[model samples]
Target: MNLLSLLRGEAFKRGIHPPQNKLTAERSIRRLPFASRLVVPLSQHIGKPARAVVRVGQEVVRGELIAEADGWLSVPHHAPATGFVEAIELRPSAKGPWEQSIVIKVQPGSTQEVQVAHPRDMGVLNPQEIIAAVQQTGMVGLGGAAFPSHAKMSVPKDAKVHTLVVNGCECEPYLTCDHRVMVEHADDLIEGIRHAMRATGAVRTVIGIEDNKMSAVEAIQAALMARHIPADQIAVQAVPTKYPQGAEKMLIMALFGVEVPSGGLPLAYGMVVLNVGTLAALGCLLPRGEGLVERVVTVTGPAVQRPGDYRVPIGTPMKFLLDYAGAPAESYQVILGGPMMGQAAASLDVPVTKGMSGLLVMRGADFCDRDDQKIYPCIKCGECVAACPMGLNPSLLGMLAAMRDYEPMGSQYHLGDCFECGSCSFVCPSSIPLVQQFRVAKQVLRERAVA
Candidate 1:
């Protein structure tokens, strides 16, 4: 059966088919020049913030560790470019909070070559050593999760991981960085998979690419053959293209036909999933003994003039990027990631982080005026129900949210299951902002639980 033929039948039910808007899918990745100054947020990852090791006025080279991992949950931060530390103070973060960050003033005429702290041969390292080495590279999910890669690869001693699922499904619209990585970095991807297999003890690896990217599938297959890797040990499988198909649970279902138990993880099903970009970077960095200071980001959307994928340094500010990408001088909305799940930029001062995959700039004229439209009552239309990929009742959840009945929204309605994909909000005829309501409800519930 062809992967394209299985699009509707095999895909998870109730995902919206939004316009792909992949304008720069074919654009090759280009390097973005260093910003005058960069801000390295200590709290970019999900866990404890890294502790700054460099003092103000200290000169640092690219890839040199500026901060140390505070704990096992945290990952160290590396200098994105050769510069002198101007300050280590509070800086604007994408999440609308002031976080402790190391500000570096780039030295003019610096080549910005990465200074490898130490090089290691992966051939002699044991599984534990590989897991330890993953932390040294400062790797994270790269798919917007920002979860530490080392923590994810380290399974409990008693548990057995059967498969390492590689996510090549760049499901989010306007984000082609991952797609470009799959096409151009196939060799690194294969090498990364080998290390991941050894680390997690997965007998085989299955890379799930959306059918829309058949070229990626072919590229990966060719790389596997060129490296003389067997098909059974590593395979590229194209699942149907759908929104949120890049999500771990949905991708697992599309590949193995099994659902991860609710409130549990893919690990519960004896599987571990990693993003292709994350693994590809790991493949290139681990052998060179370098830290992650740069990533491929898709700079695109209507407001962008030179829309393409750029190899962006970790701490490059949004304003610098927008200027380089040739955005209009007029008003526009700049989003840090894709429209579906990305957040509106709080400020252009916020620098790009490890998890940021794309920068989407939308002209004001591109979207409908939300404030101008009146929010009508839901007529109990089943559109939201039909569009929700998680199979939750957005109508009921919205009602509960309006009534301030937050407890039932979670205990009874399973509001915790919502991943905020905005599918329900997109299809709502009443324009009630169902996803926003769910986010507020979840936050309230969490606060109450903490109280």
Candidate 2:
């Protein structure tokens, strides 16, 4: 679990190194005033969409359930603030498309209110009760996956999970949300890890953080000591400073010295990975009997005048959020998540959902010149291959994608294993858009498979 070893660990061999632009790490978490209207997307999580129970023009209280899950794969959606259900219709979202969501207009100047609850001591709840409470709270993976945390904890009957990998590596360039959470709320993290251990039946948990943040590691270590949580059962280990080290596969490999077999989850190797923010929120909500209403989102970039992290309520509008965060309108390109795999916002009308972890407003100076950002032919420099964490030949994939040979890309090059971390594009000497080309190729192959 030594993250800073000059000789890299067993699994993660080579990943590109990008400039870590964590501007908000120095600042503390802040809060923003309630936006006028909040839009809660039903399909924020990965699986099935939640079904809305409230109709338009109906009034709902803060923390009231607006949408409930229809199946085990989905997570419920709760009211972030007191408001009237204005509409249930298609709206702009982070996926760069319109999605069906509940639109609620806040009562002007409504008092900031939260649900009243008693903290059920952690020891009081049994295994099943803890899992039920987590599901009721609408908790999802906050590390940008947005998968239902409850579902993740519910390991299959046959699969034996030996190690619970807690991801603290905010390795994505320009994102410090998880880092800030670990530094500021370390106590909650330990509590969260204990809860996960109870749910998963895992004997031990390992907190894997990148070597970049010595401060975070110190804070987490202090928390474990203060709580008298078994230091050996749950240890804080610093991982190497490399792109894609934050990925579940790479982190599990770094910690256990095992590679996840091709086309398999970490569970295939007896491991279950969860994000620190997701675990911290579980620690906060499950004990208090309160549902998920807000989350700490990183709102920082060069285009932002006052960059910092904020405890933003879910359903907050992107436009209103940027305005409150002092984001310069005409000076930056805005995206909903980290620079490596995040999608750009076609319109600021999109509202924050469970999946929107960071609002990156990068300016022109933070990017290459528009006209100069041209794709060049690869000269076979082998940098992309050397940088690929999965060891796939991006040069070959890009060639196949250009030639419209989608079959060979997946069958021969193992395209399904690529995590799309953008390491190849980051290190390509020819400035070739290797990641984008692979994405296009994968999509085409998937469509063909269904057809």
Candidate 3:
């Protein structure tokens, strides 16, 4: 370890060290049984919504494609279980809107065996072929950004990628899915890294894990040794455990000591970063030519009775997950990721999508005592200034948002760079929801632009 880096707190400036409530980190991942009904949304990814291929009453087997990609930026969706399409209608989504969805009713006694497509030897596949195969898997960034994996891997011709940064830093509190994936699926992750490296023309791979997760680091290093991959080609480094360190820019900064330019991507730095869970899913699916139907999710909180990492199918309802996890009977609040940045679910009926990493349930005092409902006046204390990773003046931004001065927030204050990490809100002593105000301000600006 570099003494200077250690002294500078792992060298990435301005981040908080929240209590890592990683309850499920030590637990082995357990597969949840198929739900009786699944509501598969067509627009799970960030691009255009998928076109439904299977109509109502159409029988589909597990892993069979029920929807096709709408465009180059979209991804297909597969049946999570052998079932008949019950309906194709609008359903509530976690995003607080009605979205087109395909509802399926599982067949009685139907074995949920996934019917694999054309399996190929990944070693022989070229870069384009690997990318095409990855698109077929319906993989997305499982680290809460549901951007299509294939799109992310498809580097532009103008840009040259030199490094593939594998993010194994599950920095969010109470989320252990990525940690478990790193610990148990290290080999698969390595294979996926190789594929990603090929797809992006990256010559070397680096897995950045939080120092707190020594087990995952050890597991990945051992896997690399077993595969005889050279350290020069692939290396695992432990970064400081800090909130939002798993963010691509932050991770890249911590690992390489370079800052990605504001309003830019890792591609600009000749690098591509991938989440550990996303790559592991690719490693498991690409070789078998299978679609992503399930993912490992951390179901934990103070209200959960059976807290653990679970292999949950896509489109599994939050209600089913809560029931299985033995959520408290009383009214509870459920968020779809970590406490810091996760969105609170508007309805339990919404199905788990590709971006969801954890199902956090808080009850009683933990739920009702939250300061979310309280909005205090900004004291201009400058805590948000210190907490902001992007070095933006969130206090000024918050003040501008209060005055409905949306345009200035973007034009002068660099509002687009916020990324809504919730750090400002977390550190705000006045309980002002700075991130939320920024979100509204940005939305207003977008609407204005359209007008």
Top candidate on lDDT is 1
lDDT of 3 by residue, 213-269 (tens): 999999999999998998778888898888789888898888877788889898887
| Clash totals for all candidate models | 0, 3, 0
Q: How close is candidate 3 to the true structure, as a TM-score?
A: 0.95
Candidate 1 wrong stretches, greater than 4 Å: 1-9, 369-372
Please state every model's RMSD to the true fold in angstroms: 2.7, 2.7, 2.7
Per-residue alpha-carbon lDDT of model 1 for 276-335, expressed as tens digits? 999999999999999999999899998899999999899998788889999762478888
Model 2: per-residue lDDT, tens digit, 1-451? Answer: 3222222334378886788888888888887788989999998888999999899999987788999986988888888888899999999877777889999898887766765444677687777777877888889999888989999998788987767889998988888889989999898888888898888887778888999888999999998888787756888888887888998878877766677777888876667899999998887777777778889899888788888888888999988989998987555789778888887788887888887789899866676644577778889999888988887898899888888888988888899998889888888767788888888988888899999
Best by TM-score: 1
TM-score of each: 0.96, 0.95, 0.95
Q: In angstroms, give how far residue 202 of model 3 lies from its true place.
A: 0.6
Name the regions of candidate 2 deviating beyond 4 angstroms.
1-11, 116-122, 369-371
lDDT ranking of the models: 1, 3, 2
Cα shift from native, residue 130, model 2 (Å): 2.3
Q: lDDT winner between 1 and 3, please give it.
A: 1
